[model samples]
Target chain A: MNKPASLVVLDLAILIDMYGDDSADTICPALSRFRSEASKYINQLQHAVVQQDHAEIARLTHSLKSMAGLIGACQLMEWSQLVEQAAKQRDQTMLANHLPELTTIWAALQTELASSLLLYGSADA
Target chain B: MTLTRNIHVLVVDDVILMCDFLYGVVNKVAGCRAIKALDGKAAAEYLGNERIDLLITDIEMKAPSGLELAQRVRSGMFSQTPYDIPIIIFSGNAYREVIEQSIAFDVNDFLVKPITSAGLTAKIQYHLQHKKVLKPMSHYAQLVADVDYAKAIELPTEDRAFSVAIVRELPEPKADDVDQREAASKAKEKKEKKEFLVWPEHATTGYFQLDRRMRNFAFNVSCFHNVFVENCKPVAIESERKRACEAADYLFHISKNIKQKDNRRDFWLLFQQRLDKLQPHVKELNSINIKHHSQVLVLLKRLAYWWMQTCSRPLIQINEVTHETADE
Candidate 1:
């Protein structure tokens, strides 16, 4: 089995290399912010989609995309980009279709990243 | 005065979460204290009373906006102290006009939001240590012009946008002409797509000077890839190990370069995170003495594609030309 072929969950090694023993100290707050902020935006996004508020949806997802990308949530970032573009273009159908997937992806990301953060925190401690 | 004691950062954002995030990020740096302002008016009020070493404000805030805050500080309208205060406009919008306006207002840097802690800290520290004296907007304009001009000069007249004349009349339609036009259109479309794959303008750090310093980095990655291919050594052999060692050297060189540029340390750190993801694959490829190392090659190729996509093909192509010209 090629170990290289698997998707990387978190590049904790790089973070540790960068921040040294302070890796968790730096990343934990950012990830914590991501958790709270992402949840708020996802709720806003869903409401915006229901109201067909394309501009508001675009604005909300744009921040979500940046935050997701910052935390190395690749799939979430990619999905946010699509939703942002669709919202910008006022494509209701596309936004409706992808919003659910984005929600699902965020759930998976939360679980995966929580464990990743724990690993870093424990290592640092 | 000690660096940390003197350094005061004002973090302005309409969203309380973002303000908290920036405050958290700033306090991480040694000798830095971050004060949060919820909107433009609050930030303006802070400027009136307190001495802020660095100002990081979001651009899209309502009523007296970040732009307004920047203008007020520059003009010394709010404060008694009259000097250039390092202000960084961190916003989600990369609208060209807004950027131009921000630069005109003498905003030190325009960092796109959703910025990592590292990227944000780098700009903050850089601006805090070395306050900008030059007109940032002009530097940005010239940077864009220089990039465009360099692209034009290096391309053939047929390929240059300046040489493309507007034709009002179509020659009498013919089958051969139709096929030729269609082929040209297809080729043009492909080129346009490639051109669009550049570093986002909104994410520009207001420092074009770093590009010159980083030129070597762009070359080193390319050179490592080329050397590996040219040698044509078997993957399981000693030569393969040598190549892995050489790749590691390039990685180390980049790490050192990032370290030396203290102001840009966080920015480079963000990029390093992405590079780190590719490292394990390289390590795996190096350790395994076997055939079917195609995955490693593919990963390297993908990394190269991402580098080009991020740094931009035009800049890389121009660097290649300069290198070739120098070699000659």
Candidate 2:
């Protein structure tokens, strides 16, 4: 009578029938591509900070904010907003404080991204 | 493997994040597709055209609410009967009585929000696997009729494999007249035996010998005795076939969390060990008509393999775990 929780998540097996393989193939790549692009954008933000390119940092963080939101990155989206604000004010102190939080966020993202991608691969395969 | 390939899954919640989080994980599983609904109204709409295999629903929706939806479905006014899909309630709520009552309403599983993939996948597979084994049990059950189910017992020494066959006598034909039909049906019910048998690994023979002295594999049928038992009944919980296959893979896991034997025992020792272990539970697991026969069947079958694989003995035989007749 009692069952585990995972069954709730896997009840989504109908897509393969309705959309065919192309729609089916999109799930894993989309998740992997999302995480990969996010990582690359974060890398650019790190480079912009090193070069003291404030404009590029602000621009990159803005897009990163949306991408993080779209991907369900909880805290990463929250703190990236602050990083974006610091860039607008040209405040070195705020930007410096955000680096440690950004690093923490990025590490957590990596951990979850790895797991998510791995799951998608198995499901898609 | 794709037992539920076309099964419709409904994901419901007030929060978009939770919905997407649930959808993202479930959408990847093969043989399943998900429908997204931000609220009760959205969910009800999806239920109109599509048939959902399972429901992963958050309880506290704004307008109609999850409880309200459950009540609506339970009413005869709307029919979800054709699919007979199971519903799982998801919530952060801590009301135990409310949840228990929901079980009275026949909700399949309860999952808290912020679900883990392991927990979620395990639960889904459990129900799915339970369902898979029940197919044979049900199909065979429909064919059974009342008869003296305790087939004649065979006690042979371990030297040569004893041929112990269970002759499941078919039920007598139904009588024509109304009075005869009523009487015959009643008589049929009284004599019916457990109409189902699941062979582990689909073994050609239920028992094989470890020693020549005594019958190493003694099978104690529910309807009869003087046979042997080896282990607990198979997991009778409903499940998808693919899920049971995956769960079977965990027999090798060293974790003590699972109860089945995954270790080895001596050849001679297996006889007495199996007798002592299996003799007592035959009657209990045979109480298949108990609550959940399918789950008990699965548990018993898996237990047979568990003992076979784990024991120093190479084979295990189990019979009469269930008694339903087809001859009525």
Candidate 1 per-residue C-alpha lDDT over A1-125 given as tens digits, one digit per residue, 9 for 90 to 100: 00111223334333333233346666776577677788998888888878888778867876775566456565565566667656665667866777777656777778876886686663421
Q: Which candidate leads in DockQ?
A: 1
**Proportion of native contacts in model 1?**
0.13
Of candidate 2 chain B, the 10-residue stretch with the lowest lDDT total is: B206-215
Residue A95 shift from truth in candidate 2, angstroms? 30
Across residues B1-328, which tens digit of lDDT does each residue of candidate 1 receive? 2364657888998766667767877888778988899888888888888887778888766667776677667666655434377888866534433555565566788765446667677777777777677554445345434655334323121122211100001122353777897987687555433431222321222233333323334444444445455555554344545555455556546555544655433244334544554466556645644444564455444444334323321111111111111100
- Candidate 2, position B248, lDDT: 29
TM-score against truth, every candidate: 0.56, 0.32
